[model samples]
Target chain A: MTRRIRVLIAKVGMDGHDRGAKVIARALRDAGMEVIYSGLFQSPESTARMAVQEDVDLVGVSILSGAHMTLLPPIRQELDRLGGGEILLVAGGTIPPDDAAALKAQGVAEVFTPGHSLEAIVRWIEAQVAAARGQAAW
Target chain B: MQPDREPRPGTAAARPADPGAEVEAARRAYEEALARYREALAQSPEREGLFTTLSGLPVEPLYTPSQPDPDYLAKLGFPGEYPFTRGIHATMYRGRLWTIRQFAGFGTASETNARFKYLLEQGQTGLSVAFDMPTLLGYDSDHPRSLGEVGREGVAIDSLEDMETLFEGIPLDQVSTSMTINGPAAILWAMYLVTAEKQGVSLARLRGTIQNDILKEYMAQKEWIFPPEPSVKLVVDTIEFGSQHVPQWNPISISGYHIREAGSTAVQELAFTLANGFHYVEACLQRGLAIDQFAPRLSFFFNSHLDFFEEIAKFRAARRIWARAMRERYGAQDPRSWRLRFHTQTAGCSLTAQQPEVNLIRTAYQALAAVLGGTQSLHTNALDEVYCLPTEHAATLAVRTQQVLAYEIGVVNSADPLGGSYLVEALTDQLEAEAEKYFRQIEALGGVIAGIESGFFQKEIAEAAYRYQREVEAGRRIVVGVNAFRQEEDRPPEIFRIRPEVEADQIARLRRLRARRDQGAVTGALAQLRQAARGGANLMPYLMEAARCYATVGEIADTLREVYGEYQERAVI
Candidate 1:
C-alpha cells in the first residue's frame, strides 16, 4: 500500500490576499496530495494547533502583508512547542530575497516567491517528505 | 492584393438592383480572401498558432463589416442615450475631466494625513483612503491579532480621534473622499460621519464613497468578518441610510477591481461584478426600498488591465447591460438609475518589480483606455506598487500619468473614440454574451450568495489564476520583464519601507485613547449597538452613537460579532 502525503496550508495574521494561497492549495491537490486548508485570519497558535490536529506531513504558510518578519518566528516557536517541529514548514508570497534567506535560516524549509513554478514546489515537498520517512526509519 | 474585377453573371453585382445579390457577392469576396490568406499562410506562417487576448478570448486575423453587423442606433446608441454603449455622458471628458483620485494611505494616521494633503496640493482632485490590514479585518491597533500588522499596508484608525486626525484640515463638504474598506465599513463610515459633525458639516452636505461592497470580500478580497447574510444586511443598511440622510454620498461602490486583481478574466470580472450589483439591488428591494431611490447613488469600480481593447470593450458592455437591466428587469423609471457611473484603476497585478520604470508606460496606455472607455474617475498605480506602497515621488508620477492622458494625449477630445470599429463592436457583443451565460449559471446556482457558498466563485477564480501562471511559466504568454526580456541588474528600485516604530506608536496611542476616553459611555453605546443587532432594527444609528463616544473599532465589531457570530470560510480550493 502507498502512503499519501498530507499537507496543511494556512494564512496567518491580517493579510487578506489569498489568491496565491488558493492557487497553491489547488496545485497541491492536482499533484495527488492530501491537503487541508485553514481559512483566513488565523493566529499563529491556532495555525500550529490545527497543523498538529491534522497530523500532516507538511505545513505551508502564506503571508503577503510584509508581516512575515514579525509573524513567522512566533509560528515557528509555537510549532516547536507543540512537538510538531519535524513537520516540514514552507512560506510563500511577496517576500523579498533577503527576507527569504532570513526565514530559511530561522527554520523554514523553503520559501517560494511570486513567479515560482508549481512543479518546483511539488518536487521540493516530495523530496522533503521522502527524506523525513527515511530519517524516521533510521 | 487584387484590383476589383468585372462582375460575373452569377455575382450579385451583376444585378445591381437586387440587394440580396449584393450580399451574396460580398460573401463570395470574403471566401476568396480567406482562400488567398490560407495560401499565403502555407508559405509564411503566422507567429503563433492561435492568437488570443490576455483573457484567453480568441481573436480573428481581421474583422470586417459582416462581423458584428449591429444597428448603430440600437446597439451603439448616442452618448447619454438609453443603452449607453457609447458612454454614460454625452460630452464625457470635454465637459469635465475625470477626477484624478489616487489611492494613498500608510503608516500612522498623521503620516497618512500629510500624504493626503500633499496629493491634494499636487492637483489630485479627490482622495481615496487605504486602510491597514488590522483596520480592514476589524482589529484595534492594540489587539493581539494586530500585533505586527499595525499601520503596515495602510493607515491604522482605532477610534474617531484617529479618523479626525486623518482628515483634520480637509473640508469634508468640499473634497470628496473614497475609502477602500470592507468588513468594518459601517464602523469606519460612522467615524467619518461623526468627524464631519464635529466639523459642523451636515450629513446632506458630505460627498464621498465608502467601498462597502461585502460580496467581493467573500469572492476575491477575503476580508470578510461576519457571514454573508449579516454582512449583506449591514451593507444594505448603509445604502438605506445614505439615501435618506446623505444624498451626495455613494454608500456602496460595487467593485470588480479586486476580482481582476485576483486573476479573473476580463469577462469574469464584468460578469461577477454585475452579478454582485444585481444581488445588492435584490437585497435593497427586499428591504422595501424603491429601486430608483437608492439605485442612482450605486456606483462601480473596475480594473483597467493591460489588454487594451478587451478592457475597453468590457467597460462599454458593462454600461449597456447595466442600463438595460435597470430599465427592463428592475422597472426603474429615472434616467439617473439607468446611468452606470464607475471609477477605474490600472491593474496592480500587471505591474512588475523587475524593470520597474517600464510600469509607467504600461500605466499610461491603461489610463488612455480608461478615458476612452469613459470612466468618471481614475487612479493610476505607481511603478513600484508591486513591491510596497508607493513613495511620494511614485504617487506623484501616477497622478501625472492621468494628467498627461487628460490634457496632452487628445484621447479626451472625443467620446467613445473607437465606437465604430468593427473589432471593438464584435468584442463588446462577445463579452456581453459571455457575461449572460455566467449570469444564467449563477441564477441556476440560486444567485451570488449561494454561488459563493458552493465554492463556485473560488473554484472559477482559482482555475483562471492557475491557468495564467501556467501560461507564463510555459512561455506561451510573455510578461516582458518577468518572463521575457530578462535583464540582470545589481540593485532593485528603492521601495517605500514602513518603520517598525510606526506600529509601536499606533499601539501606544490606542492604549492611551482607551485610558482617557469615557469608558462607561463607550460600553453603553456598544451595548445599545448589540441590542440593535439582536433585533431587526437598523444598526447605523447605534453605531453612530458608539463612534461619537470614541468607541474603538474593535469594540463595535466585537459587539456585532457576539450577535451575528464570526465567519469561517469553508475551504473552497
Candidate 2:
C-alpha cells in the first residue's frame, strides 16, 4: 500500500481572490491527493502552523493583492521555524517575472503565473515528493 | 391580397404546386449538403468538438427563427420602456455620451488628490475612488495589520482629516464621486458627507455613489469584516438613510465588476449580481421602506470582458431582467425604479502582463462593447494595470482610449446598435434564461445569504475558473500574448511605483490627528455608535456623528466589530 500525497493550499494576507487556490486544491484532490485548504485572509503564521499540524508534503500560497513580496517571506520563515522546511513551497498569482525569480531564490521551489497549468503543478509536486522519499531511503 | 393565396415575397416565380412537396425537396437537398460537409470535415475537422462562450454557454453553428426566438415587444421593448432591453434612456449616447469615469487612487491623500485633479483636467467626467487594502479591510494606517500596505493599491483614508485632504479644492457639488469601498463603506461614506458639509455643500446637493454592496464582498472580493447577517443589515441602513436625507446620492452600487474579476464567468457575474440585488430589495422591504423611494438610487457595475458579443448580451439581459423583477416581483411603481442604470469597466482579468501594450487594443474593443450595450458610464483598464498601478502616462492613454470611442468613433450615434442582430438577440435570451436558472437555484438554497453561508457561490466560481484555466493551458483557447503568438524579445513597460514614504507620512499624520483631536468628543461619539450597533437603531446617523468628531475608520469599524463579531469564512474546497 502506497502513501497518498498530502498538500496544503493557502491564501495569504488581505488578497481575497482565492479562485486559483481553490481550483488548484480541487485538481490535487481529483488526482488522488489529500488536500487541506486554508480559506481566505490567512496569516503566514497560521498557514505555516496548519501545514505542520496537517503534515502535508507541500504548501502552496496564492497572493494577488500585490503583497507577494511582503507576505511570502514570512510564510517561508515560519515554515522553517516550525520545522517544516522539507515541505516544498510553491507560490502562484499575478506575480511579476522579476519578483517570481526573487521569490524562487528565497526558498520557494516554484512560482506559477496566470497561464500555468494544473497538470504541470501536479506533475511537479509528484516528482518533488518522490525525489524526497528516494533521498530519505538513501 | 388574401394571406393564404398570395405567393410569399421571396419565393420563386415557378415553384412546386404543393407546398409539402417543395418542403420535401428542400429537406433532401439539405441532407445532401450535410453529407458533403461531413466529407469535408473528415479531411479537416473542426477545431474542437464543442464551442462555447466565455461563460461556458454552448454555441450552435447557426441560429434561425426556429431556435429560441423571443417576442420582440415583450422581451425587448423600446428604450426607456418597461423591460428595457434596448436601453434605459431613449437617447443613450446620442443625447450625452456615457460618463468617462476612470477609477484612480494611490498613495497618501494629498498625492491622490493631485492625481484626481490631473485626471479631471484631462477631461475625466467623474471621480471614482479606489481605497487601499487597509481601508477596505477597515484598518487604520497605524494598525499592525496595515504595515507595508497603507497606500499601496489605492488612497489611504484613515480619518475625516485624510478624507478632507483627499477632496481638497475639488468642489463636491461640481463633480460626482464614486467610492469603491465595502465592509466599512458606511464609515467612509460618513467621512465623505462630513467632508462635503465642510466644503459648504449640502447633503441634498451632493451627488455620488458609494459601493456599499457587502454581499459581493462575501461572494467574490472577500473584504468582508462582519458576518453576513449584520453586514447586509448595515448596507440596508445606508440605503434607508440616503433615501431620506441625501436624495441625490447612490448609497449602493450593486457590483458585478469584482465578481467577474474574481474569475467567474459572465453568466455567474450576471446571476450572482442580480441575485444579490434582489436580496437587497427583499431586505429593504422587510425594513418597511417603500420600494420606489430607495430603489431609484440603486445602481450596478459590470465587467466588459474580451468576449464582445457575450459581454454585450450580458448587459442587455441584465437591464431587462432587473426591470422585470422590479415591476413584477417587487411591485415597484416608479419608472425610475424600473431602470437598471449601470457603469461598465473593461475586464482587468483579461489584461496580460506580457506584451502589455496589446492590452490597449483589448481595452478599446471592450469599451466599444460597453458603448454598444448602452452603459451609463465606463472605466477602461490601463494597459499596464496587470503589472502594477498604472503610470501617469498609461492612465492618460486609458482615458484617451475612451475619448476616441466617444468622439472619433461613430458608435455613439446609435443606442443598442446590436439589438436586432440574430446572434446578439439569441445570446441575450440565452443569458437571461441561464441567469433565471441560477436565480431558482439560489432561491432553493433559501436566499443569497444562505447560499453564501453554504459556499455555493465560491464553489461554482472556482469550478468555472479552473475549467477556463485548463482550456487556456491545453491550447483550446488562445490568449494572444501568453499562450499564442509568442514574442521573443520584449521590453517591459515602465510601471508606476508608490513611494515608500507615502505610508510613513500617512501614519505620522494619523498619529498627529489622534493626539490633537477632541478626545472626549471622540469617545462620546464612539460610545453612542456602539450603543446604536448593539440596539435595533439605524447606525448611519451615529456613524455620521462619529465622523464629525474625527473618529478614525478603524475605531468605528472596531466598535461595530465588538457588537457583531468578525466573520470567518469556511473553505469551500
Candidate 3:
C-alpha cells in the first residue's frame, strides 16, 4: 500500500494562540493526510526531529508571534542538518510577503499568510506533492 | 414632478428653515403610526407583546404617558450598587485606572526578568508572567520532553532557583504578580510562596493571582496534565491553602478568556465561565471553606473580542450575573464576594498576520472596548504576536496601547460611559437573558462537571467556532485583512526567528543539571512523587519537594502519567 503523506503541523515558539492552527490541522486531517501536531512551543530542533521521526512529507510551522524572523530559520537549518532537504518545509502565520520570500530562500517551500483560505493551503500542498512526483509543479 | 430648485444657504436650502417644526412633524407621524399599530394589535388576539424587544423585555414604539411604567431608577441602579450592571466601583477608573499589565516572557528567567524590569520601568503597574510550555506543564528546563521547548514558549523555570531568579529584584509584596499557569498551579504557587518567604515577604502580605482554572483547561487550553478529578482536587488544595495562609492572594482566576478565544460565543463564554466559577465555589464549599473566604479572592479573566458592543455587553452581563448569583444563590454577605473583578486581554484571535500593522488598530479598538466595559486589569497583545514571541519593541507598543487609553484618551474620566446608551443597555440585557438560559440548561445537565463530562460545553463551543469560521469563510463576517479589504501585494516586513543553537544550548544545560544534581535525591524525589501520585495525598507539597530537589517536569509528569495514564479526548463536535 502507498504511504499517506504524513504532515507535521506544529506551532513553533511561545505562541499559544492556536485557533487558526487547529482549524488548518483539522482541514488537513479531513483531506486524508496523517498529521502529527507538535503541540505549542516546539523548538526548531524538536520540529525537525519530529518531521524526520514521523517520516513526514512536509513540516508545516505555524507561528503568530513576531518572532518568526528569529524562529523559522532554525527549523530550515535543522532540516538541512538532518539531511532531510528533500522534505518540503512550509510556514504559515502573520508573515509578510517579503519575509515569505526570504523564508523561501531559507528552504521554506511556501508561506501561507493570513487570508489564504484552507482550500488554497490544501491545493498548495497537493501541488507540492504532485511536483515531487514529477507532475506539473505549482 | 417639479423642477429641481437649489436653495440659498441663508434661506433653508429648500425650505429647511423649520427645524423644530420638522421634528414635531416627524414625531406626530411616528405617534400616529404607533396608534394605528396599537389599534390593529388590539383587534388581533395573537399580537400581544408586539412592542416588546427581541430580548423579551417590554418596549414601546414611542415613550408616551400611555406607554406604561418607565421606572428607570428601579432598573438602572447607581453604579457600585446591587446588580452592578453599570460599574463595580463608585469611582471606577476616575479614582484609579486599571492596571496596565504587560504579559511577557522569553528565553530564560534572567532574560525575562530583564524584560519584566524594562516593562515595569516603562510604566507597567503589574506583572503578568507568561511561562514557557514546559514550565506551564510543570516540567523543568532539563526534562527530555522539554527539549527544544525551553524559553521558547515563555521563560524556562526549574525548581525554586528559577522562580527566585524570575523575581530576583522584584518585590513580591510590593508588586502584584499574576502567574498564568493552570495544571501545575498548586506546585507553582508553592514555589512562588516559598520564593516570597525567601524574599522576606510574609505569605499574608503577598498579593497576586494564579490562573489555576483547570475546568477551562479541559474545555479549551488542553494544557492539563491530570484527569478532571485530580485537577479539581489540586485546585481545591490551592484554595484551601490560600485561604488559610496567603490571605491576600487570589487562588484561582476563573478564566473565560481561553474559552472565548477557543471560538465560543459571548453567551457561551459568559455561561460556561460562570459555570466553571460556580464549580470552583462549590468545590471550596465542599472543602468546608466559607463562601466569603475563598469567593472574595476569586477573580475572573476575560477576552475583549473585536465586536465592540457585544464585548461591552458581555462584561456588563458578567458582573451583574456574578453579583446576583453570589448574593442571592450563594448567600454571600460580603461586598467583596459580590464584586466580580476581572483582567481582560485584547483578543489574540482577532489579530491578523495579513496586514500585520493593522493588528495595532484592532488591538486599540479592543482595548477601548475593555476600558469602556470596565476591566480591572488589561493586557494588550502585540501586533507582531501572529509571527513569533513579540519582540521587546512590539511588547512596548502593546503596553503603550494601554497607557494611551488610560491617560491620553481621557476615557477614564467617568464610569461606564456607555451605561445609558439604548443599544449598549439592550445588548447587555439580551446577553444576560441568553446567559441565564444557558445557566438553566447547565443546571439541568447537573452543572459544570456533568456538562464537561457529557461534552456539552465542548460541543457548544466547537459548533460556535465552526459556525464563526464558516461565516468568515463565506464572507458573512468581515476580518479586515482576511475576508475583506485584502491587499494581495502586501507582505510582512520582518519575522522573529529562534536559533537552532538555542535548543542545543538548552539540551546542554539539561545534561549539566542532571550531572550536577544528586542522583540519589533525584531518584528519591521521583519515588516519593510517584508514591504521592498513587495515594490520596495532596500533590502540592510533594511536587514542591520534587521541585526543590530539581526533579524535572517530565519526571513528575511521568510519575503522574504512571498513576493517571494519558488522557485521550473523545471528539464531540
- Sort the predicted structures by TM-score, highest score first: 2, 1, 3
TM-score of 2: 0.88
lDDT of 1 by residue, B53-93 (tens): 44677544333344522234446655666677877765555
Q: Tens digits of per-residue lDDT for model 3 on B183-286?
A: 77877787788788789899999988999999997788767777787788879988887888888988999999999888889888888899899888888798
Return the TM-score for each candidate structure. 0.88, 0.88, 0.78
Q: Could you tell me the TM-score of candidate 3?
A: 0.78
Q: For residues A1-138, could you state the per-residue lDDT of candidate 1 as single tens digits?
A: 548889999999888788888888888998999999898888889989999889888889999898998888777888899999888889988777787899889988888876567888999999889999788883
Error of 3 at B109 (Å): 0.5
Per-residue accuracy of model 3 over A1-138 as CA lDDT, tens digit each: 556777988887655556667777777887888887786667789899888888788988887554576678888888888877767888887776677888888878898876678878888897787677554232
Docking class of 3: acceptable
- DockQ measured for candidate 3: 0.23
Q: Which one wins on DockQ? A: 1
Using DockQ as the yardstick, the better of models 2 and 3 is 2
Clash pairs (backbone) in predicted model 1: none
